[model samples]
Target: MLPEEGVNAVRVVVGLLVRGEYEELETLTEARRLTAAEIAAAVARHGRDLISPPDAAFREVDAVAVPHEPADEHAFHVEFPLWTAQDGLSDLTLGLTVTEVMDGVWTVELDGVHTA
Candidate 1:
């Protein structure tokens, strides 16, 4: 998949997570690999580390693509420098793996969330 497409997919996934839209988020993930409940639990466990509100809007500040073997799988490390009215540029990043399942179709897997 193209880097731009991967970035766009990451943005959508992050947006859903921020907005607490886990059900929709599940649809974008790898088939049967992730569930809405799992996503909610992950957020509940680690959300405090984030500087942005649950409903805060975000943008992709930077992204790096890592090529994988077999030529169909790629990993993207994306940073969204989240901020708030009180704090500027909080360090939160997301790791996502994008796999091409078919000719032009892809699936995403949330590797993890990180803070710095």
Candidate 2:
């Protein structure tokens, strides 16, 4: 399971994506792993339509631990079920990776909007 901090970070990043706040989203992400342009393109290509609905909401589903080579680092693939009033449950899921930068601090990496 991802820590509460990680989950909260994911929530903020997803909110930014839904709002088309790419510049703000880029600031919360790791530039070494995901570039600004890639972030913008992925959100534009995959997240734009799915998250455009004003009533869309993301509910936490589950998180899977992702192995990392560094002993001090940790990662998890977190998933959230997307829902909107007009469409009910969406086919697309909001997913992202959260990495522990140091101790309890984590950074969000956008996986974009994808079907689970």
Candidate 3:
């Protein structure tokens, strides 16, 4: 799997979570190639509503313009040219627990740990 593919998979997971489609998350996990970390990062970065307390946990990582490198047939890394958003994500230092991950699905548990 390519890095771009991984990024797309992250997007799917965010959509599923935002839409509250837990079943799609299950199906996406089987079809997409991504890591739980990537999905969690994506949700933290893109899923604005998912960004919870402490507020400083969210971060707009330099945009992922470059493709990701697949660790294997099932995993990949997020690469980028470092995008800067005008509104940039807030709380730029929170990490999430990967409760689940898949092509179009993802679930993360934010325990309020400050990555800063």
Highest lDDT scorer: 2
Q: Write the per-residue lDDT of candidate 2 for residues 1-116, one digit (tens) a residue.
A: 66778766777776776666777777777554566677667645543353542322323437899988696799998877655444556666766788897988887777766666
Candidates arranged by TM-score, highest first: 2, 1, 3
Error of 1 at 32 (Å): 6.0
Candidates 2 and 3, the one with greater TM-score: 2
lDDT of 3 by residue, 19-66 (tens): 545455545554244344554455455434442222221132222222
Q: After superposition, how far is residue 59 of candidate 3 from its true place, in Å?
A: 12
Those runs of model 2 whose alpha carbons end farther than 4 Å from true positions after fitting are 32-59, 84-86
lDDT of 1: 0.59
lDDT of 2 at 78: 81
Q: Give the clash total for candidate 1.
A: 0
Give the true-structure RMSD of model 2: 3.6
Model 1 pairs whose backbones collide? none
Each prediction's TM-score versus the true structure = 0.61, 0.71, 0.33
Model 1: worst 10 consecutive residues (lDDT sum) = 51-60
